[model samples]
Target: MRRVVLRGFSTEGGPRPDRTALLSLGLVVLFAPLAALSLLPLLWPLRLAGVPLSLGYTVWACSAGLYGLRPVQLALARLLWPVRRPTAAERERLDLVWSRVLRRAAVSERRFRIWVVDLADVNAHCVGRDLICVTTGALAELGDRELAGVLAHELGHHLRMHTAAAAFLVWVLLPLQALALLGSGLALPFARLGRHLRRTERGFGARRWALIAAGRLEAGLRLAFAAPGVVAFAVKNAAGREAEYQVDAYAVDLGFGAELLSALRWFEACAAPAAVAPLVPGPRRARHAAAREARPTHPPLERRMAAIIARLDAAPAAVPPQGRGRGRSESSRTLLP
Candidate 1:
């Protein structure tokens, strides 16, 4: 671990941006203009070289949110999202685990708000700058050690600015998401009409025209509204996966490799029953495999576990820190896999 500083927070063993986090910021820059173009109808023509006031404002807001201004944090994290709050029992456990994790990293517990997600799957995530959410299932399933590892991974995202940059990218691209939804949805009716015309055999020329028109319309709408996101995902998801690996490295460096590896085993166990099920009968399996290959958001679970094992194998033996965090005995450490 090296000394690093981020958004007014500095620590000896803190988060730093890796290639993936940089790539996320790059995507935010690349897509912001396209999103502005899509939202042009919302604003009348104005100054700033065909860019509207709204786009400028969006840039400002995104920048502010990225650096983690308190007001922006409150607005973006508190009001805009209907995130589930932790129950009393859940909070008690979360607080104890969280304090240890943050303490080890030298991050302020005050800097982040812990929330609970009402999900059955074991997962945790960070968003914007200061929010770390763990699923209810995770709270139920993971003991303090395993939960600490998961939380460490998310805290790494915050320190590296992964979630903050991702939030900016998502916010700036909202217009494009909206456009895709509206334009692509309208194509279904036209598609049905074209099919109806083909069945009626309405004069060969007219039927041909109907097919051509509807097909072109659907294709154009898809290209214009829906395709950019796919292209962007193709460009960015690689980096996103790499960022996960980097955070895994961070967790290892921060002394949670063993704990995190155990957590991954739990995830693997949870998924085993489903992975062993018979494949859906058809070429669909091949198509789905191809799709997963084309754009996987996270590295495969096995790959992550392998990487963690490799890190743990190569790491030096754990040396006690200057302070005994939470006054736990050295025998109970979660450093090695």
Candidate 2:
């Protein structure tokens, strides 16, 4: 058996303090004191029984909610993000590239399962502990090497336990999200009533203005209630973008730097039309421009490519040339078998 060592590639990219995680942690810390104070009255009786039940019950409830609902969450994930087994042709094409990547990483084939999703977006991701999902568009758009690079990047996420962390974070924020949803639900009737009033021809000028004002008030209230969750989402996505960079570096360390760069360039090219189409002087262009501003979960392709290039430049000798002899060479071993 031939051993392929990743020279100069340390998996220990030390202590990336995710700002989103920190923000979430900070929110929890802040909430703890407030919760303890708010629940003090209710928990007074329990405290009389020699239990610090205010904080204790809060902690227990949260822990139970997160852990107990985990299995249900996993099941829901599968249902929501359904993927199919790859067709024979797809399997054959992907297996060659995937097997090579696995061999390079020295990971057991049994440890992970790959599924093809019917999505138009050119992307792939790691789900949970052992599931890697690739979109049909990704297979269509990326070359074999580029595809391998994507898979390697997702694998990096898996190896780093990012998926698990993300799951846990989602669990932590679930109640907040539910509260936001409930706020929206409660506000919906008021909004509908206001709209109905505004649309009524019978209404006088002042009445019409009053209905509009009511609508605005309801909207404001809804937004106020949902603001925390919205802020949390933005923070979480910011951290997620940082994770993308880390995973990109991991792929680079695995000797897929150039391939990943190429893949990013391909994404950039694909996005160019949507980006440029908005700039063309037309009414639809405004909508297109607005759509273009809608941020994706991952960092910008240019930023990701730059990060990968930086990694490549930092360890130029670590990227072994393809088709090189297995015998000792100055450069790192070829990652693609």
Say which candidate scores most in lDDT: 1
Instruction: Give the Cα error of residue 237 in candidate 1, in Å.
Output: 2.3
lDDT digits (tens) for residues 105-166 of candidate 1:
88877878888766555667675677776766677766677778888888887888887776
TM-score of candidate 2 relative to the true fold:
0.66
TM of each candidate vs. truth: 0.72, 0.66
Please provide, for model 2 over 1-337, each residue's C-alpha lDDT reduced to its tens digit, 9 standing for 90 to 100: 2222222334443223343435545655544443344345446778898887756666745663553353553454466565678999888888888997787777877777788777766767666666777878777766777777778888777676666565555544555555566677778888888978867736468777778787887898788766765666666556566666666777878877777665665565554434432111222111010111224345555555556656677553343333111222225334332
RMSD of each: 8.8, 10.6
Give per-residue lDDT, candidate 1, residue 195: 79
Error of 2 at 176 (Å): 1.9
Residue 60, candidate 1: Cα error in Å is: 8.6
lDDT on C-alpha atoms for all candidate structures = 0.63, 0.59
